[model samples]
Target chain A: MTITTGYIISALLLFGIGMNGLMTCSHQLRKILAVNLMASGVFLILIVTGFGTDGSAIDHVPHAMVLTGIVISVSTTALALTLACRIQQRLNRSADETAEGNDDD
Target chain B: MNGGLTGMKKRKQSMKGKFKRKDWQFATLTSLLIATLVTFLCWAILKEPPGEDLTAEALAPLFVQSGVTSPVTAILLNFRGYDTLLEVMVLFLAGLGIWSQATVDPTNPLVFSSPATHPTKPNFHGPGPELILATLVRILIPLMVLVAGYLTWAGGFQAGGAFQGGALLGGAGILLILAEPQRISTIPPALIRFGIVLGPAIFLLVGVSCFGYGGNFLQYPQPGAGSWLLLIEFGAAISIGITLTTLFVGGRPDPKRLKGTDQP
Candidate 1:
């Protein structure tokens, strides 16, 4: 019933929606979540593109790629979050120091 | 994330008379983790099995070599081998990147606090049941290790392969981190380094080995299913281990130090 274009559109929508949130969200963690959402959506589309019509599959290449992609995405996300945590720690430290300065003022 | 964060224990000891150490935690992580879980649930509800046929199609010669069935080993070692090779490199790069980013060394045990503040969580409710932590890892690590081994070997015939098997192994490491971080330190740096770099290095070596025979890169002449498959899977195990470990811990778990060890 569904077309490849439709699959693509769904994937794009997922990515776009998540991207909007990632770009706009002030919360650091929310940005990470949004990125994750976008990644999932993209993988979904990749999977859809690789599907066969009735019984035969169109392409196995994409599926294999997606399999690899999923683990890579997960790993990248973990690294990104680690960065977020580090940044958060730095920000918190400066904020505390600034608060002390303002108290003196 | 809700517990065990002490960045400043040493200096705080000097000023302990005035400042109280407190634990701080954001309640939001649990919510985010839950949300991620739900999203995965939805995906599972709608997921399709990735066909072996798909992989077969890819490995089947595109134009000239269209007559024969595409082999999994062929794809891994040939057709899209570039992908696998680069993927291995990515793992290596990630480790190097994280290593470069390390502010401290892994050899140091994470101390109760840093030199500044007392070891206290502002939001620490209580501790996890210590017995549960120890017992859970004791049972789970072995089972997980077994499953990881199975995934690596079973990958040749089943829906799972090197990546899934590798992921399972990586998951075991993460589980160990969660249940008993003390054990994580005992794993040597050399082993970790070797394991993380093994996949790409070995993959490259294999490619070169084939190249020496006057063939293009990764064109292993050994087409027999049993022997070739074993070689490729072994490579997968190494790459999976390296990639997943670095990714799971975001490069490495270089905790804060106890400080006095610098002398010894």
Candidate 2:
């Protein structure tokens, strides 16, 4: 197969793996990682779309779009992680309070 | 009583077995679905005919007018600047969301404030940073800053740009925070807030200023586009760096802790 097709196939595999992880994993951090993997697969597809089969010039627009995508993904990841940590903290606190009440009983 | 206890234990074992079986079935089904979807996508891509890229060709002739030699930079800062503008705002909003969700104690920036009697702490509790790591961080931080500056400047002509420089700066800031959390607290919170706002505010200002020159928003006049792009890049790099660092810190800095009123 051509190199472009190879890349496309791998990108699809990556997306599939990410999707599987997102569906199966119970951990919040793992879910975040899965989403990031999916984003990377999409980015690979975008970059490959701009790849020239012949001696044509590569598209700069896709590269710029990828850069923007990377930045957005980073920010979103940060926000998601912060939210996850907050949720975990709340859960831990409530668990501790419940345990304390049980001990008193 | 013994028979009842044994029956309860058997029931629990059966329940566990059922749950495990359900989990396996769910995983298999999901995997099958994902594999099918991916196969279809790949087939579609392989079958599609190659199309001509009109945008790249259109971008070629306008490179000089966009004021930067690097086509990517030109596209990012001049041609499709609105996307970058919104991107910066998105980053700003993310930082705002993080800050609103939790507060980090200034003295121990690693510890976030929660309503719980015992606040959740990260696993890496220690007396202080190790001597080797502290030294390494001290050595690397200055070099990182220098490289970040170079990247931002080089973006006008080559591959480097504000995002890369800002990410590097953010890495440096993370190292600094990790090595000396207390040192971060000593810096005024107001300054941090200013740094976070600097990039988007300047970007918006530059975009709005285009109207004064008798052009639409973000429409740079042909003559002075390079300097304007550079100005925006510098501001964006600083803001991105600070915002990223704050995000790593994981919450807003507590003003009370900064004032030394709260020792915890």
Candidate 3:
């Protein structure tokens, strides 16, 4: 297979791995990581598509789009991580309260 | 009581085993489904015919008019300015959302804690930041700032831009926070708020002002396009840097800490 096709296949594999992780992992942090992996795969595919076969000039449009995508992904990941931390903190607080009640009983 | 505790431990072990088995099966099924979907996607990609290169051809002719020598920068800040404008807003919104959802966890050792307040808290990470790390941060932060500025300027003609520069600045800010979290609080909250809002505000202003220049929204007049792009990039890089650092800080600043009334 050509090098370009090889990259495309690898990118697909990455996406598949991420999807499997997202579906199977119970941890919120792991799920967020999986989503990031999926995004990376998508970005790779866009870059490869922009890189035309043999004698063609590199496409700048996809490069710009990828840059934009990267920024958006960072924002989303930060927000998700914050939400996850909040959830964990709340869970821990409730667990502590339950343990205190058990002790009192 | 000992016997009861042992019985409870055995029950928990058995329950964990059952859950593990279930999880293994679920993982296997999900992987299989994902594999099949990926294989189909790969087949489709391979079979698809290559399309004509319309964008590159169109972009080539208008590259000069877009103001920046770098095609990517020109496209980002000029041609597709709306995407960037909305993107900055999204980043700002995320910062806002995070601020609203939670406050900085005081228990986190990464945050500044006075010896008097957290005397009982074990130093799990280390004996705290070493002199070597402090010196390294001191040396590197200024350099990072300089490089970030260079990258922003270089974006007009080369492979560097506001995003890269902003990221670098963000890294420097994170390093500063890690080294001395207390130092971050010394900066006025209002200034931090301004820094976070600067990018989107400037971008919106520029787009609106384009109407006076006899062009559509975000359309720079042909003669002064480069300067407008530079201005936008400068504002965007600073805002992006502050926004990223704020995101890492993980919550809104405490008013008491900002006012310097709270000891530690």
Candidate 4:
């Protein structure tokens, strides 16, 4: 297979795997990781799209778009991670309170 | 990690055991269908012919002429600058969200009004970094700083840009924070707020200024586009660095709340 086709196929497989993981995973952290994996797959596709065919140079627009995508994805990931941490903390705190109440009984 | 993996495996096994035969059959069928669809899509891509290089031929040259030698930088900071501006705002908004979630009560001045403590102390019982990590950070910070500066400057002509430089700077900041998270609290809130907003604020101000000059919004004054682009990149790098570091810290750092309570 041509290099372009190879790259595209790998990226597509990555996207499929990531989506499957996202849909099937029960854990929040794993879901986040799946999302990140999906993002990386998209990034790869974007970069590959910039690749020139027939000896032409790579496209700069897609490169710029990928850069912007990377930054935005990072922000989203941070926010998601923060939410996950808060949820875990709240869950643990409630569990502790329940344990204390049971001890009193 | 091995224990966690095994625990997860056990849970998955128990969950599978609870599912009926029909449920398992359906799930297997769905997965097979999805896999077939993905394979077909890949095959379609492989069968497609190579397309024209319109981006390289038409857009790249125009972007480069905007007083920046690097086409990607020119596109990011000039040709499609609105996207970059909004991207910074995305990061800024993330910081704002984290700040809002911080336990630091804004109305309570007592918690946030403390003075700076010594920087060397480890405040949290959270797993401390190894001696090797500390030594690596000490040796690498200056080099990272230098590389970041170089990347920001080289963005005018080469493959580097504000984002790359900012990421490097942010990495350095995160390393330091990991060594002593409480030291993050030593930074004044006002300064942190300014750092988070600076990039978007400057970008908007510049865009608005163009309106005053009767040019289209975000159009750099024709004569000094290079200098204008550089200034914007510098502001953006600083803000991006700050925003990334704040994200890593996971909360708005309050110097007033630090004081002696930060010590372990």
**What ordering of candidates by TM-score runs from best to worst?**
2, 3, 4, 1
Interface DockQ per candidate: 0.17, 0.74, 0.74, 0.61
Candidate 2 colliding pairs? none
Best by lDDT: 2
Per-residue alpha-carbon lDDT of model 1 for B1-264, expressed as tens digits?
A: 323234355456656644332211222443455457546644653465444564545444552232113334345435677787777666566667655544333332222222332323333223543788678878887897788778767655556556767777778776765554445567766677777777677778777887777777866554443445456667767567656665555535444442344532
lDDT score at residue B96, model 1, on the 0-100 scale? 71
Give per-residue CA lDDT, model 4, range B143-213, as digits (tens). 98899989998999999989999999899888777665545555677888888889788878888888877
- Of 2 and 4, which scores higher on lDDT? 2
> Given candidate 4, what's the lDDT at residue B136?
91
Q: What share of the true interface contacts does each candidate keep?
A: 0.14, 0.83, 0.84, 0.67
Tens-place lDDT per residue, model 2, B1-264, is 999999999999999999999999999999999999999999999998568778778778999899999989998988889999999999998899999888887777887774333344565567888899889998999999999999999999999999999999999999999888878778888888899999999999999999999999999877989999999999999999999999999898877666766454
TM-score of chain A of each: 0.74, 0.87, 0.88, 0.89
Question: Of the candidates numbered 2 and 3, which has the greater lDDT value?
Answer: 2
After best superposition, candidate 4 residue B208: deviation in angstroms?
Answer: 1.7
lDDT of 3 by residue, B99-207 (tens): 7765553333244222212222333345556899899998999999999999999999999988999999999988887776666656767898899999889999999
Off by over 4 Å in 2: A99-105, B1-13, B115-122, B125-127, B260-264
- Please list the residue runs of candidate 1 whose C-alpha ends up more than 4 Å from where it truly belongs after superposition: A1-10, A98-105, B1-77, B103-129, B251-264
- Backbone clashes, candidate 4: 3
**TM per prediction:** 0.69, 0.92, 0.88, 0.82
Off by over 4 Å in 3: A99-105, B1-22, B105-129, B257-264
